[model samples]
Each structure stands twice: as structure tokens, then as C-alpha cells.
Target: MRATALSLASLPARPHKTADLAPGTPAAVVTAPPPRRPRGRPRKTAQERSDGNRRRQLMDGAAQLFRSKGFAATGTRDIAAAAGMHSGSPFYHFASKSALLFAVMNEGMASAVQSQQQALAVLAPQAPARECLRVLIRHHFEVLLGPRSSFIAVMLYEWRSLTPVQRRRIALVKDSYEAAWMPALTALGQQGLLQAEPGVARLFIFGALNWAVQWFAPDKGKSLDELTEQALALFIHAG
Candidate 1:
């Protein structure tokens, strides 16, 4: 099972109460969320921007390698070479392979979280509880069905590798993301509108959205709109 921010969140979850999307927004275009640039590093200049882009490419290539194969199976040389750099490129941007793995996962999750927040923002005011959920589901699937799906699955299975300190820090950002949907779910449940237990509702909805990483292909009639409609229909009628 995937680890959702919902299962063990410490903060209160709140669903959006209103939304203002143009009725049909593509998941890929949910607003260009700012990428999760690594901190502890100074901002880049024009020259440095080129270097940063190169470094990002290396990290992205490494992530692809790690996701397609297991971490233990991929070596630094493979990643560096794939990124069009020598065998030491990953070390230039990350401390070690573990750091690179975490960074990739962190960036992917951050992008997803940001997209969710953007989608939620449009719905946070007057959208019905159930309607808000359908929107959330759509954005979630859109974000995952892209190339980052592999990283997502890797993160799900490799979280145990994170250090204790790293774990908590990641948790903080993740909690905020999950909390976006909690308010509406809780409110609906209280009103006898939720389909099942709170945990189940949260898990099932998240699971359906998350599962897109497995077999969702744009060519199989599984476009973002189709998934969005299906998810909305499933959850809305479940009660």
C-alpha cells in the first residue's frame, strides 16, 4: 500500500469549499508550479543558471535510471553518463546516491503538492464538498500520469531509506498537501455524505488517484478528463 499523508498526519485536514476552474482544465496545465529547487544553495546568475540546468538534467536522468530499475541496481556512473556528464556529476549536485534519490522524490512530490494546492485554491471557497474532491482527484491523476510516475512508486517503496531527520522534514511538506482535502471529507462524513470510514474514504480516494501511475497511458482512452469524470462519478455516487 502507498503511504498517504492522510494515514498518519498530525495536522488537521481541510477540504476546499469553492472552486473556479473553467469547467475543464488539463491536469498537465494546472499552472506551471515552481519546481522544488534544492535549498542551502545560493540563487543562480545567468552563467550559473546554465550550470543549474545542467545539474538538474543530470539529476533527472539519474532519477529515471533509479526509477526504471531499483536503487541498488543503478550505479553513479550509469547516472552520470546518462546525464551526459562524467561519473561524478551526481556528487556535484548531491552528497551521495541516497541524497539524489531523495532529492528526485522530493522534487516530484513537491510538484504534485504544489499542483494540488493550485487546484484546491480554485475550489476553496464555494464548491460543494463532493465536487471539490472530484477536482482534487483529477489533478492528482494528471500529475502522476506523467513521467514522474516511476519516481512516485519508488518513493512509496523506498521511504524507509530516509534518515529520521529527513523523514520528519519531508512529512511537514506532505502533511500540508493532504490537509487540503481533509476539511471537506470530514465535514461530509459528519453530514452522512461520505461513503465509508474516514480513513477508508481518504485512502480509497487517494488510492484511486495514485494508482494511475501503474497503467495510465494517454493513448488508451485514459485521458485526464476521462479519469476526472470517472473518479468524480465513483466518489460522488458512493454515498
Candidate 2:
């Protein structure tokens, strides 16, 4: 018994595995919980959230007012009231009415670019160039004449109201939106589906489509789908 005891006592102590320990055991020296990494976007503070929401509200209200009443005639107080904010609140979000106008246009163009990307992404990998153009044309119609289109309509009318710097800034985004069409147009030109040069055809196509904003009333005449087909027919040669 003495020999056995000595032999057992001399054996090295077995390290305790984490799985073997009760969660709260005092002997669990290595049981410090892992530091939790933050998940997803960092939480916005209450004030930050309120500020963002107010800014969006101001833009939306400003867009509606600018579209209905030309930018030159829409006053800051009108925008504030339309946004359900104090008369002086607009200055907190924008330096002046003109700045707000630029914001509206900039945001509108950015949204249009995102919508165009999403529309193009759903196209079949091997879609014909003419079909690609059809998708782009339909999506453009939605951006200009469909529901919640006041933002872009305001942009169409208020371009001259923006400062030179603001106009240049907006033009950058405008070019980005237009650039998406080049590949399809180029392909169509190579296929002899476009009568004019690709660059010239792009300009003519946009001019025609943007003009619809002036006379298109959803209540009267052809639906947007029918309009899209008509536009496609007018722009593309018969196959």
C-alpha cells in the first residue's frame, strides 16, 4: 500500500480540461470569457439618429416643394413647414435653400445610380445588348415618372439654380449614371442595331426620355410599360 501510494503521488498532476469544470468552479483559472467583438454597424446615438432622420425629411420635403414650385420661388420657411420642422430648422441641416437644392439633386442622382445598378444586376449574364438597353430604358422611366419621382424631377428643373461648383459636383454623379449605358450602346452599334454613333445616340436617347417628365401623366394615355416598349421601338432598329 505504501509503494502504491508513493507511485500514485509521484505521478504528474493531470491538467483540468475546460470541459471538465463546472462553469463557476473556483478552480477554473483559465475560464476568462472571450472579449466580445461588436456585431454589425456601430449603434448610432439617439441624437445622431434624430439628426439623420430630420435631414432625410428635409430633403424629401424640399424635393416636393421644389418640384411643385420652382426652386427660385420656394422659400426656406416653406421647406421647413413642409418637413414639419421649425422655420429655422432648415439652416441647421443646410446653409441655405440653394445648398438644400444641391443636396436634393445629389441625393437623387446617387439613388438613381443605385437603382440602375440593381436593374442591370438582374439582367441575364448573356442578355442581348438590345434587351440590356430595354432594361435600362424601363428603369430610367421608373426613376423619372413613377412613384416617388419628385426628387429627380426637381433636379431636372433646378439645374440652373445650383452654383457652378455644385453643378460640377452633380455632373460627376450624372456621368457615372450615364456611363452604365455605354457597353450596351457600343454592342448595339457594333450589331448595327443603333443608327447613330454610340455617344450621339446616348445623348439623343436621354434627351427623349427626360422630356417625358414634362407631359407624362400616369392617369392619362399609355402605361409606363407601354411607354417603355414605344421608347425601345423608337430607339432601336428592327432586328
lDDT of 2 at 49: 35
User: Residue 156 lDDT in model 2?
Assistant: 81
lDDT, candidate 1, at 7 = 36
Show where candidate 2 strays beyond 4 Å: 1-51
Residues 96-164, candidate 2, lDDT per residue (tens digit)? 677677778877888898889999999999999988999999999999998769989988888888777
What is candidate 1's TM-score against the reference?
A: 0.73
In the order shown, the candidates' Cα RMSDs to the true structure are 15.3, 19.9
- Per-candidate local distance difference test: 0.66, 0.79
Quote model 2's TM-score.
Answer: 0.77
Count of backbone collisions within predicted model 2: 0
Maximum-TM-score candidate: 2
Q: Write the per-residue lDDT of candidate 1 for residues 1-239, one digit (tens) a residue.
A: 22353333323233221111212311121222255566656544433334346656765786678767777888999988887778765575666676666666666677778778788888758878887877777777766776566656666656676666555555666677777888778877877777677767887888777776666667887688887888777776556
Best by lDDT: 2
TM of each candidate vs. truth: 0.73, 0.77
Off by over 4 Å in 1: 1-50, 147-151
